[model samples]
Target: MVDKADKTAKVAPAKVKGGKKTSPAEFIRQVQTEGRKVVWPTWPETVRISIFVFIMMIILSLFFLGVDSAFGAVVSWLLTLA
Candidate 1:
């Protein structure tokens, strides 16, 4: 029977073989090809996302303010009992 250590041994990822370096023109061409694949958002979509983020920020801040106030009041009342 195999030992537990042998059964659970880690295997390393294969290393990439070194290949020929790409020329500068080829690199630029590849970059342009990749750039064409990107899909950028329009102005209205960006504005909507920004507005949503701001609303969430305000709502969360009000929630935390309420929680902090409640905890402070409870601690103050407990101190008075001592």
Candidate 2:
């Protein structure tokens, strides 16, 4: 009655010791290699993303304001009942 999926899930991956540890000097070299792969956004792309982010921020601010006002109204009404 055991499912194949359940059986496979019980088996764990083998653990290795000390095979993947990198020296501090080697780590810095790896970091520099990765740093070279980064390409910065063009000025136009940066401007577009900045505008998009600004619009989203304004939208989220309005949404939170409305939500807070609704909660405040509910709380004020409940307080009046007491």
Candidate 3:
């Protein structure tokens, strides 16, 4: 069972074995390949995301503004009562 478990464990590739180092060009190519595999948002998807973020920002701003105004009014009213 222990031997079977060891064999089933995922192992990292020994890319840098024996102190062999990666060159800058090889690193850049690896990065480019990984970037190509990324799922980039389409133009329409990006626009929709931006609009959703903008609307949420506006709503939260208004909510905080109202709360601040209410607190200020309460403080002013307390000062008048004194």
Each prediction's RMSD to truth: 4.3, 3.8, 7.1
Residue 42 of model 3 has an lDDT of 100
Which stretches in model 1 have alpha-carbon errors above 4 Å? 1-8, 18-36
The clash number for model 2 is: 0
lDDT of 1 by residue, 1-82 (tens): 8899998999986543355577789889989999999999999999999999999999999999999999999999999999
Cα lDDT of model 2 by residue, 1-82, tens digit:
9988987786665544555667789889989999999999999999999999999999999999999999999999999999
What's the lDDT for all of these models? 0.93, 0.92, 0.94
Clash totals in order = 0, 0, 0
**Top candidate when judged by lDDT against the true structure:** 3
lDDT of 3 by residue, 1-82 (tens): 3688898899987767576898899889999999999998999999999999999999999999999999999999999999
Off by over 4 Å in 2: 1-20
Clashing pairs for predicted structure model 1, backbone only? none
